[model samples]
Target: MVAIALCAIGCQNLSLPSASTATTPVVIKLSGWGSDPTEQKLLKQVLKDFETQHPGIRVKYEVISDQYMDVIKTRLIGEAAPDVFYLDALEAPFLMSQNVLEPLDAYINSEFDLPDFEETLINSFKYDNHIYGLPKDYSTLTLFYNKQAFATAGLTSPPTTWDELLTYSKQLTVDKNQDGRIDQYGYGVIPELARQAYKIKAFGGQLVDENGYAAFASEAGLQGLQLVVDQYQKDRTSAQKSDVGTNSGSEMFGQSKVAMVIEGNWAIPYLKETFPQLDFATAEVPTINDKKGTMVFTVAYVMNKQSQHKAEAWELISYLTGKEGMEKWTATGFALPTRQSVAQKLGYEQDPVRSAFLAGVEYAMPWQAGKHPAAIMNNFDNQFVSALLGQQPLKQAMQRAQAEANKLIRAME
Candidate 1:
């Protein structure tokens, strides 16, 4: 029988004699994104709960905010990476290629509810027909609108089609404290490659070619992506990138500066906590050309291939993704449960905000995970931003993005 060592406060090995006196915990590092105070607090409770149940492990958690990929790559290459880290579905291809992430298929089969997970979530982590991780949380984009703003605009329901969205946005936009200036925006768009993925997919445009090369330069792709940009520059109903600092849309929505915005499920908790006074509700993100959809951003818990503590790590992974741990970890309303059984058990699939989140799961296009995504994203972001700023025709921008992405994609192959 494999022994489960019990320790507390930290993850340092208690087996060593003199090491026991060390102030630092037996450090098992965990890395992820998010420095939001509420998320951090929620994590603490989960960690504490883990320590309480399994006494021997001490976790040293770190949030990688800036140059995230570079830092993670450096640590992983140096073998100093965290024992448990967040693996995005988009970057799974790159990380899996590095041969660093351990396969957790056996663990899932042996210890957990193998059939209980949603097939869509399970398939995201599968590489070479092998499982690399267990998804801990997921977010799908939705249309968040300020209720009061809609009421003021004399609108009762949110827009459903592309034309209606444009008209509604223009109507809802106002110069509330008009000093010959427009203060409130009708809508907002995040002009980055990472966030705008759903635009292409919504209109049946593929981001990659049949051979898994960059393919977002198609006529359909340009049409889908341009619609959002046109709403800002041409239609004058969307917020410009510089209108709000940092996360323009999220911030604008929180302050009621934008009437409608496209953000993920995480934004719900954020708005609820940060701007409690704001009257906000969510709906499915409006479609392009009358087709409905959005994006998926998900993170999974992956095991370290070189872990000296594989047995222990597997135990943790199994338990963390198991019915009990998943229930506890997702209990705080921080994220949407990826497992169908868990969703059903928690009634998350039926809850208002959560149900809207759940509704979008089937339609959400996965965020890019192609190898050399950094280079591709760099090209895509620059070109896409050009379209957003009205500096380039949408066709030219996407063509440039697709060509650049293909070049980088070819080099990696």
Candidate 2:
């Protein structure tokens, strides 16, 4: 009777499942802004691969199509933010200072190879010696020129200096049909503070003071900006997107409304897929003030401090920003890899068109303003556009912009 009872107990134990096999998968909420369809598809595939490798964790990806930063900020305040999300470098300073993001230092292990990422990009997410985010990818501005336009203008090479670029612009501007209205402009200009930050730095001008106040109205700043103003108001060789009835600089260039434009890596896939017939080539942005300069824009994957599944969140971030995942993400050339190993493995430096962008990274200025970036960016862009339209003098416009931005920053404080 005792042996039969023991045998019955053993049979019951054998019928039950193990704890590990019966455990439910943790779901991580991941969020980012909407991108091109191809980029979105690639990201989805990466997530799928991550799930395949990590069957115990599933990522619930969400795309906030518009006002991404505003939505994220609101969600963070309500403690309803995703476990992991994308953060732009421009907005990193503010959020990193807010103590809402998880400091990733503890979660990172040596095998993760933090040193593999580009120093410039990685440093952007570091604040107070704590790494809050890991940069996923970066893009540096490059000058994109129409090859057919160059041939028509009898130009053998892209401009090597800003002066040469202006000269080339004059030659490329044309009134093809002689209808009195200009058919094509030489350059497409984006009169926004983000695109012009490097130009401001070209002449020792800065976007903000040591205390983070607006400081871009100095005499040195105007020198670099005057070049842009002169091209638009004085020479009339440059056209804003609105002037050409186009939506963006890339569109203006791709549609042949402008012969040249300064754009980033995203424009390459866009131009190729959208305007397949356009013959375009990219070159390092022409030197400004006899110094090499361009803007580097980067985005990082960050963790929410309030996440219930912190380990699962880090797993998603590490996998997405890891070498293997970065290689797969950047393989399409829609964006450049932030990891040096991935960049080397992909060989973007050897690519004929992409090489220009890669070369500019060494001298590129990260696209970050102070903690209060929107105030400075908005005021400067509004006034700069006014100056470009001859509505006001450059000096006065910038001065007004600087004062207004500083006033807003003070109010925020």
Candidate 3:
């Protein structure tokens, strides 16, 4: 009887598991474009803290140093993409329509405080009433002017309107040398679609038609863009990076090649690190057409539709874009937090350099259009440069570019 009782007890013990055993942790991969070392360090720290909090998951962070979107698209096509990745607002429309990104609406819960995000920034990533991505951070184009240059030019403050800017540019443009070539230009012009989209919208011009085709060749569109063309071709007060032999507009401004440059927040850290002695101040972008307008750029954290561990992926996205994580990431001021609460907590609105950007968020237009922006942007840049160089009229250049863009758009559809 004792042996039978002992055997029964052993059988019962075998049916139960030990408390020490735990399920294996899931590994989720994340990808983003490479940034400065400081930015990269902050991201790694955030990831580490997340790992500590959620022991059941490990994150694999990867940086695609160059051609990020092209590489990410290729990976997605091959079914070997990361679980989560950064999606720029400019590219968001195209990617969202691809049906490759996981819709995040169902995963977001009340605790996430979804309403805390700036509606303008949030809407940039929304499509068809679905939240495809959550903006991590955003920046608006602000007028960054060289203080010393301003003083030398006998100016007291930054230009307040487009007309004032043109007047200011003439005074700011200087040729120190006896040679015909200019030494310092009044402004550094990007002359790209990403930077010029707002100008198109300023004159009641739409970037696309109701059917999502390029329509910026309209009379209203050319009216706004003509301002840029006049500034470059007729005013001759602005110089592009190629003309200045610099890699970027910010660099030209930092090197004193231009008195002013319309740049985003990323230039702040770069200018501070590369040209600490440069005395510069930022102000809200000048008004155009008696209306406030500036281009707002943002990137969001999006999940892959093919991710095997959807729950784990959502957890990572939630944490990274959450209040605490966003605060930590934006602490260094490398990027502006998308969360209004976080921005207030950080006091970026009061910071002199960042204040200008914060102020423009209200009136800024998001830098995105319909699904065929890639085609639209490419054609516009190619033709707009010709117009800027005086090779073609603004209206004619836009007309030709729009026709080509619509042709490509039709092909894609």
Candidate 4:
């Protein structure tokens, strides 16, 4: 009965055992947000492979599709959450502090190769010295540029410093029609908090205070963010999604509306499939304030505290995050493997485009800011965009955003 329901919703080509099986196997429920069709197919294959190895356990996978966090939180509060589920690093601190997630420290052993995982990726899920989750995969931002655009602009190489990037943007910006409308923007900008977190740190500013309140309005933070505003308002060389009439920076870059964009590994496959004829290459993101910085995003498998199948749940989590399963899951490049051994085996570091992303892992900042990042990010993005559009001064805008974010955080507390 459970297998039928699972098969009806996004589980492809899953074959379950008949009722005549010698022993009734334990059913372990797993849940995650839906991804691209190719990614989903790969994940389902991983789950099926696990089931084949452990005939005593039946894995039931479900896709929440939308409003993933809200659905998971509701199910958790009602004690009906799946035994294991995908938890983003952005949400890890909040959930780990709530006493709702099971600590996996006891379940992991030396042979599990705990040291094989990336230090930063594993540390994101660590709270009070207990590991609550294990990162399945991670991605870091890289500079994506169109080779043809660079050639047309007579540029020889991608920018390595912020000053060079600004200069290059001017050379790359063009208006072929001379109708006072830009035919091609020099750079694509995504002004969201996720993409800009490292900017705040570049100038010695932080996203939150020691008490977990919003504190990005410091002079240091404003100093770093000013570059973005100046590029948009003064230079007019960079554009947002609405300016280009595209859905995302990736789409805008793929459409040749922009010459360069800061994107992650996921965009590699996307650009290949959607714009095969476009000549593009990647480089490490330009340095700002003479500092190297980029953002890292990762998702982990976390166990539910109230789950009845804790043992089986750990088995699934360990296997999926283990070297073997991660290799198979990340083999197709939907996401980069988090394990060092798997990364070595996959040899993505040698790939031209991917090597640029791999270079960022050493200095990338995890996309997390305490437990209330969602609230902080929401307020900051709203006011930051206003500042970018010249509605208010950058300093004033950040001050207002910080105040509003803290008020909401207090209310939530």
TM-score of each: 0.87, 0.93, 0.92, 0.94
Kindly report which residue pairs in candidate 3 clash with one another: none
Tell me the tens digit of each residue's lDDT in model 2 across 1-413: 22233223223322211223326888889999998787899999999999999998889999999999989877776668898999999999988877777889988999999998888899999999999999999999999999999999999899989999999999999999999888889999999998999999999999999999999999998999999999998899999999999999999999999999999998998899899999999999999989999999999999877777887888889999998889989998888999888888889989999999888888899999988999999999999999999999999999999999999999877
TM-score of 4: 0.94
lDDT of 4: 0.89
Q: Least lDDT summed over 10 consecutive residues: which range in candidate 4?
A: 2-11
Q: Compared with the true structure, what per-residue lDDT tens digits does model 4 show for residues 168-228? A: 9999999979999999999999999899988889999999888999989999988889999
- Badly placed stretches (over 4 Å) of model 2 are 1-22
Error of 1 at 381 (Å): 1.6
Q: Please write out the lDDT profile of model 1 over residues 1-413, one tens digit for every residue.
A: 00111111123332212223344445566788766787788777877777677666677778988877677767665567777888888888767755667777665664477777766677788888899988887888888888999998899988877788899988987887878667778887787766677777766777776577787778777777878787888878888547755465677888877888888877877788789999888888777766777777888898766565665566566667778878887887778777778888889877877777788888777786476667667888898888888898888888888888787777756
The backbone clash count of each candidate, in order, is 12, 0, 0, 0
lDDT by residue (tens digit), candidate 3, 1-413:
22233223223321111122247888899999988788889899999999999888899999999999888887776678898999999888877766677788988999999999988999998888999999999999999999999999999999999899888999999988959889999999998988898888889998899899999998888888999999998899999999999999999999999999999999999999999999999999999999999989999999887777778888899998999999998988999999999999999988999999999998899988687788999999999999999998888899999999999988877
Strongest candidate by TM-score: 4
Q: How close is candidate 3 to the true structure, as a TM-score?
A: 0.92
lDDT sort, best first: 2, 4, 3, 1
* TM-score comparison, 2 vs 4, better candidate: 4
Which one wins on lDDT? Answer: 2
lDDT, each prediction: 0.75, 0.90, 0.89, 0.89
